[model samples]
Target: MDLDQLRTFDRIVRDQSFTKAAAYLNITQATASMRIRALEQLLGVTLFVRGRTVTLTDQGMTFLPYARRIIGTAQEGREALRRVERGRVSIASLRTLVSPLITESLIRFQEHYPSVDVVVREGRQGQIAAMLHEREVEMGILCWPNIDPLVVDLEPLVIMRERVPLVVAADVAARLSSRPEIAEVLALVPRVIALRWWQADPETAAALVRLAKTSVELPTGPARRLAIKGEGLGFFVNSAIADDVKAGRLVEIAPVDFEPLHRDTAMVVRSLAALERPMLADFIREIALECAKMGEIIDDRLDKVVPRKPWPKPAIPHP
Candidate 1:
């Protein structure tokens, strides 16, 4: 009758074991049994055969479809209510671009809708899109430009297209300057990398081999530290090193003459739903505005296409 009973009933039927279902549901076996019994009594029908096999009876089979439908409907209802109550908006973002402007936009959104809760998970551009497609998250911020077919809505947020030029500690740069051969330089240097986030293409890699003093790789935060320590030059988004460039902790080396990597940041949402939730829609709008305002400096293109909606609402703070 209730969601708890329906969930327990569904789990029991799916798992075919009341004990297993109870464990899965994080409840005691006795409570699971009582709930099922109560549900069966309410319907006045024996839904499950009382045996080790735990098979559904004829009556159970008849009620199975309805039970599933009930459970699904209940789940949808719960998700909707939670969305409304928490003003919860789930978003996945690339780790590099959670800047002050983005933070301000979120703060402003919360000021308008105090109940809204924002959850941000960080991943690569491709992975963020995948999360949206799977419905694991409602929205995504990604680095790549092209919209995938699976995306229900797309808003392009442009960011500065600052190429992560290679950089090294001043001492390291000085030490490597004398009689550098492409191979020798690469062998001497250990490249710092931001693990999975940095999008270094193959051509860049090959060119780096020819010019890099060593191919040292490190995780993003630590990689910055290593570069500061004069370990080796690493490729990273220009935003990541802005402070160091200003403070003289690291220096950009001679042009690698590599293709300039222009990353187009986008807000991606699944296409299936109409995004009827006001809180979620508002959250998306805030991000879109932030991107439009800040991403232009990097020549990042922020674009949004909703099949039905002809135009986005003007940027206005929520009342």
Candidate 2:
């Protein structure tokens, strides 16, 4: 029999009166009687004795435990499903952006949604893009100017803009004039260091070839380290080396009339449908907040070399 019929039967046995059972279950006495009758017909057995004080039949006694267990198990299963749905969020992000942009936001998110499990996967932009297309992750934080066709459906939120600066060791900068010509700086540098992705772009590759001899291609961390040691000139996002700049460990070389380079820091999802989840939405908002903080940090660092304008308002306001 159905769960409602079983519940009505159990309630009737407990109350020992159809009238009282109906009242307890918020149903009319006639409806409760009909449900009991239907349950008995389904099982082909009588469940109760009709008397001044009702009592359970042999069949009712045999079935009571099974009915209780079935309802309890079903409720447990539903609750388990709900917990699984509410308690997990998966995000993929670029290796470089994770520390500067995501770390603080993730900590804040954990504070707010203590029960929610946050899984962060780190990869390069291409790898993150592939994971999104394969449905391996729900959200991604990455560098913009990505033209991959797989990410065509990505709904992007531009959280920050990363400034790429030509940096050298402080000692190296002290040897040269305060504002050296681009050619003079390039001629003195032993080699150029850059991320592998920079060489992939034709225009950037050509520019690098013209600027200096490309001696090393490494991740942001190692390249910054080598540049700080005066081993080579490094090109990197300002956020990665902000502390170094402030501490006088690294110097940002501003060439005469040099055009500043920048890339967008974006958070993306596969589709608008992904935003329907409250967990994902809240996590995204936290990421945005963290990115805004990082933008300020980057601005402060960049301000040392060139004055920066205030950031524009965000298109999407947090709810």
Candidate 3:
């Protein structure tokens, strides 16, 4: 018999009245009677005796426990499905942002949600955007200033604004006098190590192209390593170079003519509603916290190398 028929039979036995059971089930009394009749017909046995006081037949007594077990098992199965759905979160991010930016946050998230299954995949922004659009991933972490039309449907939650700094080995810094002009420094160092496909900021791109006669293109990790060995100057996220700068392995170089380059890094989702899941929401929160700490590290490093200067006011400012 169907679940409804079995449930109706159990309710009738529990309540001891079809009328009361129907009221509790939010169905008419006649409907409840029909369900009981249908269940008895399926089993080819009488389930109840009708009189001034209704009572279970021998067959009904034999079947009550089985029917209860069936309903309970079905409920357990549904709950298991819900648990599976709630216990997993999937994310994709740019390969470069994962190390210094998300590594600690992911560790904290795993500690907090020990049972949750978190999968993080790394790719370029375009690849991650495609994953999000195709539903291969629920969320993504990408560098900002992205204008891909594929991400038009996604919702962005900015985690932090990252300073893009030009850094060199300690020896390179020592060669240039304190706070030297950008052009003078560029004249000395004619080659720069940079990412091959990073074109987020046109000003930074133009500056590097103008100063450096030769460009060494590599991935983030290798570029940093090569820059550390004094192969060439490096342009990198401030957080990525924070440890090296603090430890005197690298030094930040101040660009005189151009304003400091910055890019926003964000956690993006297919929809705002995806954050409603507790696991996803908690993970995003942890990322935000970690990014805040990264910002502090960048600021502390910048304070040491870049001099504090007030912004120049606009000549025409009435708006």
Q: Give TM per candidate.
A: 0.58, 0.64, 0.63
Question: 1-319 in candidate 1: lDDT tens per residue?
Answer: 8879988988998999999999999999999999999999999999898788688989999988998998888778988888767557788888777773368778877777665667778776667777877777887767555444555355443343435566777666666655454444445557534334343454665566456444555657888888788766666666678788778888776543445443455565555253566566666666766665544545432223322233334346579
Q: Write one digit per residue (lDDT tens) for candidate 2, span 284-305.
A: 7767767776663222112222
lDDT of 1: 0.67
- Output the worst ten-in-a-row residue range by lDDT, candidate 3: 297-306
Tens digit per residue, CA lDDT, model 3, 196-299: 34436456656776577788777777888877887778668776788899999989888676566666767777787786676677677667677787663222
Off by more than 4 A, model 3: 1-86, 196-199, 296-319
In order of listing, the candidates' clash counts read 25, 0, 0
Each model's Cα RMSD: 8.8, 13.9, 16.6
Global fold similarity of model 2 (TM-score): 0.64
- Which window of ten consecutive residues has the lowest lDDT sum in model 1? 300-309
Error of 3 at 209 (Å): 1.7
Candidate 2 regions exceeding 4 Å error are 1-86, 197-205, 296-319
| Selected candidate, larger lDDT, 1 vs 2 | 2
